[model samples]
Target: MTTKANFPAAAGSVVVPYGHVVGNEKWRGSEIAQRLQGKIKLIFEDGLGLVDFHLSNRICILYISEADLVAGDDFKRRLVRFRNANSLGGIVIVERTQISDQYFIAVQKLVVLELGMVLLPVANQGEASQLITQLVREQSKDHNSNPFLRKQCSQLLEASVFRTVQQIPGVGKTKALLLLQQFGSIHRLCNASVKELELVVGQTVAQQIHTFLCS
Candidate 1:
């Protein structure tokens, strides 16, 4: 069976796992590996070899395991080695069994070293495949959206309202926006009496704003 690693790199590189293979569970492994291979270029090997291969490829590693996972000093050492050897994009460790806190901590440290994140309790190969596909789709959408443009617009809109509200001592951004929306203009909002403001900004805030403006 082809592994997820066999699938083409989604961006520059990605690492997928063959998962766990208990005795006589070769079929499961083969099946997952085949499905992955059909999608990308894959490398199939034991856990130790998988680690080594990730270092060599300089790609993100997706580790699939069902056995008890313990990330001890040895694993940390390997992570350090991998980091030094390759431009480690990310590390996603998928566990078949319930993970222990100790194991999670150890893996988390490895991720920190590699600048990666851990994905927990993946359940099975199918689930892992689905997760990867969804991630790719989301990433693609973000790429298409021109993050800088979106961020700039959001920042400008926030700053405009924030600065405007700050001029009115007791009116915060929310109250200010509520007043503006309800009255259709800041000038109209200022013209409103406390009783009129209360309908939109609530009684407590309206009182505060009236006191500030009257002062």
Candidate 2:
């Protein structure tokens, strides 16, 4: 997945979990890890083995392959771990092969919506690597912004009801669902008073969503 990339490291950078360093020639962790090594802070394990990588200040990115997605309940648990974690940037699903309907539906229902996962499925590892590098660069570009490519956000908005909720201005899936639950439906949420919405999703997001619905 190695390719030419230009990223500038700044004050807040990525924190790679575990001791798994990106290999030089082999590039075992894929080109994304290799390219991001110096640009990001690679936190080698301190005898406490953790997950693949950790973006403490940045959003969490998970490298999910179709094979991994179909790997029974064990892999499902792994996916759960990533989804439950704090501040997820995106989940890059590498499709070396076709993902079956059964697994695909499960992923959509179980992980994407419920956890507000920003899902991006790439054709191969190369695309995944490039996209990941781009995300890192975008994060570097604007420190106080959501560092998602325009295309990524568009795809997410089109994916499903859950994703659409996640795209409502500052409305993440969790807060969106909470407001929906309180109001009983999306239509109700749109019609809900700002004070009512604020009780569920907070003042800023509530106002943003009310404005969004009106617009």
Best TM-score among the predictions, by candidate number: 2
TM-score of 1: 0.37
TM-score per prediction, in order, is 0.37, 0.48
Across residues 1-215, which tens digit of lDDT does each residue of candidate 2 receive?
22332221221243333222221222335555655565544333222111343343344445656667667666567666655554444453535456544465445544454555555657666676566556556645544544444445445534554555666779777876776568764456657889988888889988997886666
Give the lowest summed-lDDT range of ten residues in model 2: 17-26
Candidate 1, position 150, lDDT? 38
RMSD to the native, candidate 2?
Answer: 11.0
Candidate 1 lDDT, 100-153, residue by residue in tens: 443653354234312333333467666655544333333335544435323432
What candidate 2 gets wrong by more than 4 Å, as runs, is 1-51, 85-96, 99-102, 144-215
Residue 97 deviation, candidate 1, in Å? 2.8
Computed on alpha carbons, the lDDT of every model, listed in order, comes to 0.46, 0.52
